[model samples]
Target: MTIAEDRAVELQEQIRLPRSMRLRLTRNGLTLVPITQAHWTTQRRIASQIEERLPGWTAVGEFSVIPPREGYSPEPDVSAVPSDQVLPDASKFQEDLLRFVVEVVSPESEERDYSTKSDHYALRGIEAYLVVNVLTARWTLLTRPQGGTYRHAVTGDFGEKIEIPVEDQTLVLDSSQFMRV
Candidate 1:
């Protein structure tokens, strides 16, 4: 089998969402379900915060990363792309143009978000990745991707403010508003 096909089979095995659930593909090889209410709350809060903090940037929740094929799912819980970065079509956003991706880990999603998704984002050269674990009330930020991995990672409590180094300036992320799962 081709490498992509192998990865697709692997992802289908790892994902636990129901067969009836709708799925989206990430440039990474994974399948994802729609966000739960708790996940949505956190995503919405973070998106709003980003929009407020960075005026010209747009934050998207559950925005699937467009892949070359039909079956990869690495959709971030929340994503921020520059407002001016227009795609030829609006149906989906390109993974390369994504400035930031945030994932909220749930029991079923812990492994993929922390491992497979991280590897995929890094491989695609995504600038920033944030993982919020509402169940644990902790957050982790990964940045500076190199060789299909992040070179820097910072972990902290939910209430702590984080400095996301985007471009030259830092975009402050206020995790204080995040609701616990």
Candidate 2:
């Protein structure tokens, strides 16, 4: 492993993060960001919408997701996985089981949400990745992962509708009431 990867593993194994914070392995190494109230609210709102639209799919918040890439573990603000796919008895969810991942952009995590996490999720072949920016009240939906990047992207301001195709069905998320910081 490279120095950054080794450090990421060490940090993951050793660090005791508080409930209000989450750690991520980025290109720069291990990084921590505090979860603000607005962030939590936005996450919950999105998750609720997903659950309402996609029955039988489990939408969880702040769960660890282990991508195929080594030394990269990201806890998306919200993740949707198959409810029937029995997961291992561990804290991390394998990327193969993840149908969708959502990241709410905080002031300190704008770049990571828009770039770093997007690249990582695409590389892992996640079907859909949504980025909600509370600062600007805008959202971006990325899909069609190819060659370690998203082949299609759609961006719009909050209050616009985002239609995400998952498991042969389309999840229509109404961002009209999504919380903004």
TM-score of each: 0.78, 0.87
Best by lDDT: 2
lDDT of each: 0.76, 0.83
lDDT of 2 at 131: 94
lDDT per residue for candidate 2 within 17-123, as digits (tens), equals 89898776666766687888878888888888877889878777656777537566777888777788645555678888887789899888898888888888988
lDDT of 1 by residue, 130-172 (tens): 9999888899899999998999999999889988876666789
Which number leads on TM-score? 2
The alpha-carbon deviation from the true structure for residue 158 of candidate 2, after best TM-score superposition, in angstroms, is 0.9
Question: How many Å off is the CA of 137 in candidate 1?
Answer: 0.6
Can you tell me which runs of candidate 2 are displaced by over 4 Å?
A: 1-18, 67-70, 86-90
